[model samples]
Target: MSQPSVYPSVSPGDPSWWFSDALRAEGGEKPSPSLSGQITVDVAIVGGGFTGLWTALALRERAPQLSIALIEASLCGSGASGKNGGKVHGYWASLAGMAANIGADGALAVARAGTRAQDAIRAFATVPGRDVWWRESGNVRVSAAPAQDAKIQLYVETAKRLGVPDTAQALTPEQVADYCRSPVFRGGLYLPEGANVHPARLARALRKAAIEAGVGIYENTPMTGLTPGSPNRIATAAGEIIAREVVLATNIELAKRPEVSRHVSVFSSYALMTAPAPEKLAAIGWNRDQGLADLRMFVHYFRKTVDGRILMGSGSGPISFAGNTKNPALTTDRASAARAEKGLRRLLPGFADVPVEKVWGGGIDVSSDRLPFFRTVAGTRIHYGAGYSGHGVNPTYMGGQCLASLVLGVKDEWSTLPLCTRDVPKLPPEPFRAVGGRLVRWGIIGCEEAEERGVQAGVMMRGAAAIPKVFGLRIGTR
Candidate 1:
């Protein structure tokens, strides 16, 4: 088979509305030259999304003497980095999941790294004259249904038991309404460290920073093959790259390799953006400008843009068959898009009539454990990282930190992170992976939909939800 594509198949006529808008704001981005003939560099990074760009920047910061080249099948930030919901927060809200996946100490370590990363982004974003549309209001997770309320309780209880009570606190129904009133919501959890940003603009800033720092970027260059050895060789259609060290930060594209495929699979996430409605937003009292979501297996994450538009996203899209990550219809199906719009109308009905200005979707590399893992290829000087799942905006920073340490061969805090050595559970191979994923997905949809309707899902749907338990895997791999 041909090498997997770095970008999924309309992801964005020019990436996405975020990307196109960012480009329009940029007064037209200067094009980067694609590779031609042959070239050699000290370090070669693949996949020009946030992970790859951050790695290049980190390498430049650590070793300015090293010559670095970043290759992109499309453009930097044109992948998930540009297509995301723009929630720029850390893992305080995910404390329970982290503790469950790794140990408490490990969980604390990753959360703290996330904090540092968030701070780093804030620093970069606040630099005078930069326009990433960053807002530091924080995040909220509302329990839209009574069954969903349990998740809010768990997030708070776990944080308190871990002696970080302030990291995540339980909120009353009134408190949740204070942020964004909705009859469906019961209670919620609040994380003060959360923030939001124009994801594509951040991606653009990184691209500009990388170029200014002397990192050669090859856009529209897809690697067709790789030869792993002392001097790794990466071949593209028109040129090839030879480098002493290599980094595969190519998101779901890495899933093409069995080692990664067994641990990570692709699932589509869709987002719907409403036309600017500052008045509609005010009517709902959603003035806090925080990232908001409902507690569900396939969560609905929503946030406001600088232009007064609300972007609502659903993580409940279908699983790719046989690990085929390419999203033919921009990674969306009619059902998923409908669910996203349903989330917007059901949760924040104030904007129910707001015209949807844009719709975009893309595949996310979800790990078996729902957390990312970083590792070096066995007996090779190459590093790879993926499985961001749906909560990558903040963790990709941690990814860059960890991957950078590995490339430098430095045994420091970042290099020794539990994520670097964790043995995440492996998902089933092909046919079963995709087939089972779809079943569980339907199960989750059935259960959540029933809960929302104030009823119990049928036995069959509930049993499907329990299938992951039988296989000793985390629920909702889809």
Candidate 2:
């Protein structure tokens, strides 16, 4: 008998409403068979989420003769890919951070690449039978608090300074009301390159497409052991895969690797989905397919579904200590879920009475600098990509491009892109990282809450919020 797969210990409420609804709409889809016995192939991709699935599809497109097999711990989409709030956009919103890390030219290259990846996503989402609910009405970042207005200014000014004035538009109070009449929204910035999707549906569609392309995928087949060499050996509960190359697209699992662990940490984010309230959304003039978020360090990101429901998410969930991937604070933190519900009441007050049908939470692999990176392991064919922070919906597509080029030994633009070799700042290690991270989280929450309430934060809180910048890091505050 095969040993049981070891799944992540998330909340009972997870796999989320997204996955549940996507499964119903999947139309006679049967679970993929788990791997059995020993096998060898050209490549063995681990994770089976967006990155792995996209890599498989990319590999097939680039080299039809190359054999590929992917293994997943749970269902293909059951990871963070399925458990997110489904906001999609490119790197223009992050131009300031990118430019600050890389140069202006480097930032532009990555942002343009993100746009191409986003275009691909839009095209894939709208194929004849692929009903991924691709809504492309753009995104809004509202200034719910007086202090938060600066972030909106920063995004707009950064884009303009980079000669991409069309990337973002600063909105006046009256202009903001045109999107939605939220009392909390003083003003906002509009970015044209934004969209939303039924996340699980999109992931499932990708899984289907990969299978159609003849990429072997095994669900509920977690890799139990991985020994890297020229021919990488991937041991699993039921079988083993020997492949010439391997792609470690396993999200937060990458945090356990010494090389990766130094540069990344896991932070939880929770979301609340309200029942179908199309009329209430219309009453608030939020009927468009726009995704909206507040300009807080830990933002309140919310959006509407094609079926007229609303999703309100809070990125203020707890952080895990080093190598403690199973922290319940990431998956079952009641305080974080409550904050999301509270945000829905505050931001979209028109839907204050709407019933929240579900509450789900998951972890985000946050980099020292909050951007994703891709590269190969030293002296091995094992390539990896991660640290997408919280804004991964579109970057994962770019990651697929980078990982694919790395595996093919091709030095094209996708492979040579700055993202592949950018020097990501290293995070503080061990006791200091965990202990100081908690203090910073407390400060961020306290500061943002005080600002929302039109008050001043304590000196200690403000100091804590400013601590990361002292060390050339980007967390604790925007």
Candidate 3:
């Protein structure tokens, strides 16, 4: 008889097969002891995930003498950092959208910063003793439908116009099939700068590196209250911390604050990992390790693991009601996992018989403009950055560099990128936000379905897709 699935339903990203088992191996980093008494530091960073960890490392690199303390609600890599699809690529694909929001010059600056960030990750991944399973095998943004193909064509034109010709190149159907056998793929855009890695391993490696660099890390320590004083104070469950500066790298948790929450919405995304299918993958000619994402509004991102299993994710999962990121419902949903698995099967028929090894879900903080922004919170000593729209793997590194610059009060190039702005666009409030979100979601699905059927979307569907654009928002599978 077939053995029962261990994770029959979706659960928090924490106990996923990827992070849990690997973390238990001999010599895997253990959670740092939590803070228990009053203490002070030069910099106090909340959130031990990618953003905070990167910030700690960046600070040490720039100012080796500065004392830094990083507090986490759980162990490092327990959140999205460990649970993500492990895609670390630049933001060149969003150049047109960035240019529309910030002028072309500003957009170019952001793109350059993104490129630098990608390179930084590449360097870190290859360094000795990291063991992060980093692979710079590039990525492919493919099209399986007529509408998606149309958008891919526009993206290629924009990349060329933006002088990023070497960043992305068009791929013929035959060429795309050579990389990954998918009959639905009409064409693809290949980016050689993209990379994939073992996310949990990277996070753990960052933790080890940060500690070795003399940064104090306290896990299982949650920051509960913030008191604005001459020097800001952070209250934790069993201790208090006074700091010269604070960096709030808590990505999804930013929704709890009105100033930042209004501009962000929390949504859940699901993924399914298949049992090792080395023979099947070879049979399908999917020998390349490049990460792949389809051109649907709600993206279908898939990549092969170092162990040869395919990990597939779907972005069209549940959204929080009333723009609340703290909604417990955002944690997990089995239906979402099923949908993601179905998408994976549709893309690769060769995996039809492969048993799913596990299923998981996690929250993502999406901005109204579908781009990340960073700046000091108004009238406060805190610096913050979030809103990756489900594409944060590499951007978080850029965010860390920007946060480090702000904490040091340095007015250099990293601090002036388009993302380092004070004006973060806000979404509509409650009822309207909820209703409008449904319409947009339904519209995206409708348009994608029409395209799959080789037909144009109807008036309603078109209107729904245009709603966010009408409000000057960018939404697509990037």
Candidate 4:
């Protein structure tokens, strides 16, 4: 296949440009090219988004003299890292689900590491020229229906058992209305550790800090192939890099390469930002700033931007092969924005008239279990971390640190996290993969709808609704 134009350009230059705008506004020392052609480095990191940049930064801090090279297929932050909902909340995926695969101790270790990761991000924000609109106010997960409220309760109870300090507290219906202005919400959980940041700005700042610390970064450099031997060589469009260790931080983009395609699946997520909602911000008391997410299977996540706009996101529908490979597309279909707007209006009715100023979409790597995949590729010195399952912002920061520690042979707190050697089962082939994705999405939709109707919705009901249509099985419910 011919190489595609992955370079990020600003307005009038590229159709996908919101992330580039955010980066330019943050101001950073532009990364210099990797001009010294055939160079040797202690570590060579592919994919210059959050994972790659964070890994490079952490490695430099640990061993400043270790040579490192970071390469980006496009500009840094061009992936989901830049285009996500900007809610740096705690991991929303079920810890119990992860524990089922990795033991309870393993799950707790990951959660504790996430806490540390959030702290690391905040610490990074404090450095001069690296500030990126970090907001420390916590995140509130609202429950849109009564059945969903049950799950939120279970989540709170589980958090306490896991020794999570300040376990999410339940809000009374009145309290929910007072805080969220959403009468539709029965109750919700308030988590104190969650925070939000401008992801694009943060990614660029990380890249700048890494470069200043002597890490070489090359933009518009795609790793086409790799030869994994004693001193692994990574071949790119323009040149090749030889390094003692390699870190694959490509995430969803990993599917483009045959080496990782079997290990992950790419899913598209779409988001929209409204023109500044000053009046609405004042009405909801969100002027203090807190991110918000809901309890539905296809959840809605929203946050108050420093610029006074409400950034809301949803829609993770399966896309066709062509759609998946093409540039990001902004669509008014599926009524996602309207659905998001309705949810937002429930939270702050004052913004019912606020017009959406921008809409963008990006891809996330999702494993079958919905937990992150962190492991070394077999037969290679390459270490990889991907499949964050739509929770990458904070986790990626911590994951990067962990990856760096592993690469540098430092056994620290990050190094002890369950991520280092976890193995995710390989996904089935393309047609099956696509079919399974649609089935899962459909099942989720059915369950959500049934729950809204006050019906008891179970996993069996979800499976029954979708299995025959997509999976070609009856698989009678247990």
Candidate 5:
């Protein structure tokens, strides 16, 4: 099959108004070309979203004298960085999964790095002109069924053992009902360190900050290829950038680059935002404003937007290799929307009438172990950081900082984390990749079906409980 198109067409007048509203509110400028062409810089960064912007900012702070340039394929944050769920929470997936690949000690180190990354983002929010809709409210992972309760318990214990300083409390059924306003959740594990953000605004703010700090940024400039040698040269459609070093911050988009395609796979995830939910909130009695996620292999994560709308996200489907090939027929399809809407109603049946005002989908980079891959491609000054799994918001910032430190030849706390190294293995090729993803999706669906039945009966059945581990996955514990 021919490669999928890299650019999918998006409607400018869609009901999904977050991107346009955010751009206007943030006073973001339109993309422009770099004035000085063929200029040499200390570092040349590809991808001007959060990863590249953060990398530039961190590097500037560390080595003020170094010159840097950031090239964007489109506008900054126009990709997944801006379109994500905006939950800047803890580490990706589970520590158990990370430990399975990188060992327990390494996993703990990675978790600590993530925690520090979240702290760093919070600190960045305090800067004037850099503030985005940042709510320091914690995150809660609710159990959709009794069997899933075990998964939450496992997370709580794992957090403690990993030396995570945040409080992980298991809420009782009564507490879940009172706080979450959802009767379907038997309980949940609440962590105090989590936060929600306006992803688009944050990306714009970071790019703005980097530009103000004397970093050169070029937009609508796509890097098509790379030439590695003593000094790396990045080829764009219009021109080439020759710099002492280069960084690849393109997460899922990395699949478009032949050099990095082996290390990343593109997977599509869909999200929906309900119309203003004041009435729904009143009925649910959940005004505390914590980000909520469910415990499942393919999970649902929702959070309250600043405008009082609830953003719900679900659905992980395989997409064509070409980046822009979306089946509009599949966008907000009944089955996918039902996964999110049903999850919301289960938590707050009182809000079952809330209409979904907007639905959008984006792609994520998935690595073999569901952990991020950060490394310098062998014998070259080109450093890369991608494969954040589904947890890119906070980790992207952290990964950027680590990339900055690595480029500067500094060994700091974040740089020392095991995830910063080039140790994680690459995933299998296309056919096997497609097969493995299908198996994972089947396992997750089976578990969700079992839980729905058990919840209706008010007890977990033995047959319903064994789906996750039997399929080589981790489920949170009771």
Candidate 6:
């Protein structure tokens, strides 16, 4: 994932080359000005990603009189929030962990909340002028190997045992082929609660919604420093925001802070997009627009855009050096891009000839538990949440509610959810962290490669794949 320099997202000759261009162009708000002079607010939120935006929206809905200011170093949604695959759904995969960590009742509550988050997004899209490629077509996690098939079956059983039955169901090979004609797909679990979105557009919609909800937003405003106090002061390039409280919902950008960085490890995820090919799509029976993902530790996720282009992304990319959150070189990994395209060709051979329109990558902050957690930073008024791993779209919404409940100091179910505490296990420190991540990632790649070849992974490779789970941080346990 390391590169010589950061790739410019857009160039004079390559406008609209990326899939997110349309959404950015159609975004409702122009960039807000950078913070200037001194400003005081009830709450100052750092990071304009979904977690920040949703927290702001939730705060406003809960208490309209509370003054809120949201500041972003770059444009809102420019980070993982904007760069993600836009699969929104409940965290059915985390039910096992939740039940183990919390009580069964608590786990059920969290699961229900996760499902409600999906409905909330659908409702948000109904707002006039906020259509964000809203598609409630659901998501399917297909298994191409026996191990994956077993995993999906376990997930179905877990879902039912957790009292969220019918949230996910196993699809037979014939049923899977009906929706997508992929030779690799033996079976899958279909979650009707899922939906796909145009992520950038969704972020834009949130920005617009925040503004309409009376939120003060400042773009190009990075929090350079923070001083803990009754009304903590956040220093930026142009000014400082003194707020009664602050919410750090910056996702992988959380690694910018050494303390936060230690608890999370960052890795790059790459995606590739193809030109719209309606004829080719029809030739393969990909008429359904459900989001698809393989069952692997380092998984591949794909879906169709409204324009009919195929978007393929793989999580098997490079791990960042310790505390290197903003390394530009990781933005575009050509090698990972090639692998994603290769995966797309394997899944949909009929569309192999389609021209690739764009390729991009973004960072993921992984916690030792591979789950999102919220907590109040020690000796500060700062509340933070990170470690969404790669399955964040819905969980972040849940994160927003949890953060809002904590900020308002209300004792409710959200505040009681296991994710609301600072109990998430931490990753190992520097050298070991880096070395271990590489080994685990290598093993994941080897195991998946063997699976693709229809051969069992070697004992050493399986052991590598088990390293993360050994620490209870299953890469794609869901």
The candidate scoring highest on lDDT is: 2
lDDT for each candidate structure: 0.85, 0.88, 0.82, 0.70, 0.72, 0.79
- Cα lDDT tens digits for candidate 1, 1-478: 1121121222334357798888898888766999998999989999888898888888899889999999999888888899999999877877787798798998898888889999998998888888999899888889998898778778878998998999998999999889988878889988999899999999989999999999999999999999999899999999999998999998888888877988987888888788899998888888877999888889999999877999989998888876686756436476687788888888887776677877788888999888888999999989999899988878888898889999999998888887788888888877988899889889989999999999999999998987887777874732
**Model 3 weakest lDDT span, ten residues long:** 1-10
Model 6's number of clashes is 0
- Candidate 5's residue-wise lDDT over 1-478, tens digit each? 1222222233432323456667788575577674345778889999987889999999899899999999998788877787788898756336766766677888777777788888889888767665588887788888877668787677777767767535577877777777667767778877777888888888888887899999999998888888998798888887788898899887676666655566666666667777787767767776876888887666788888777788888745444343333434234344555566666666556656666666666667766567776777778898888778778888888888889977877788867787776455555567755555445555456657676677432133333344334555332111
lDDT of 2 by residue, 288-331 (tens): 88999988879899999998999989999998999577887888
* Residue pairs with backbone atoms closer than 3 Å in model 6 (clashes): none
Candidate 6: which stretches are off by over 4 Å? 1-24, 27-29, 100-103, 458-460, 469-478
**Position 429, candidate 6: lDDT:** 84
- The estimated TM-scores of all candidates read 0.96, 0.96, 0.94, 0.86, 0.87, 0.92
On residues 1-478, what C-alpha lDDT tens digit does candidate 3 reach at each position?
2233333666544466667745975266567899999999999999998899999999999999899999999888888888889988877877777777776787778878888999898898899867787877899988988667877777778788888787778998998998988778889888887889888888887888899999999999999899976699999999999998999988788877777778887777887788898998998888877899998878889999877799999887778776566565566666677768877777887888788888888888888777888888777779898888898889999989999999999998788877886366778888777678778877877787677779988999888877886876654323
**lDDT tens digits, residue span 1-478, model 6:** 1223222242212212332574446753468888999999999999998999999999999988999999998888877887778878877656666676665676777778888888888899767777688887888888977768788777788788877778789899999988888767888888877788888778877988899899999998988998889989999998999999899988887877766776788887887778899888787788887888888767889988888888888888788888476665456566676677777877777776777777778778877666678888777778988888888888888999999997998988788887775366567788888788878877888888888888988999889878866777534333
RMSD of 5: 5.9
Candidate 2: which pairs clash?
A: none
For model 4, residues 395-455, the per-residue Cα lDDT tens digits are: 8887788788778667778776667666656666788766665666667666776776788
- Per-candidate RMSD vs. true structure? 5.0, 5.3, 2.6, 6.2, 5.9, 3.9
- TM-score winner, 5 or 6: 6
Runs off by more than 4 Å, candidate 4: 1-18, 24-31, 34-36, 256-259, 319-349, 410-412, 449-478
Measured with C-alpha atoms, the lDDT of residue 153 in candidate 5 is 70
**What is candidate 1's CA lDDT for residue 419?**
73
lDDT for model 1, please: 0.85
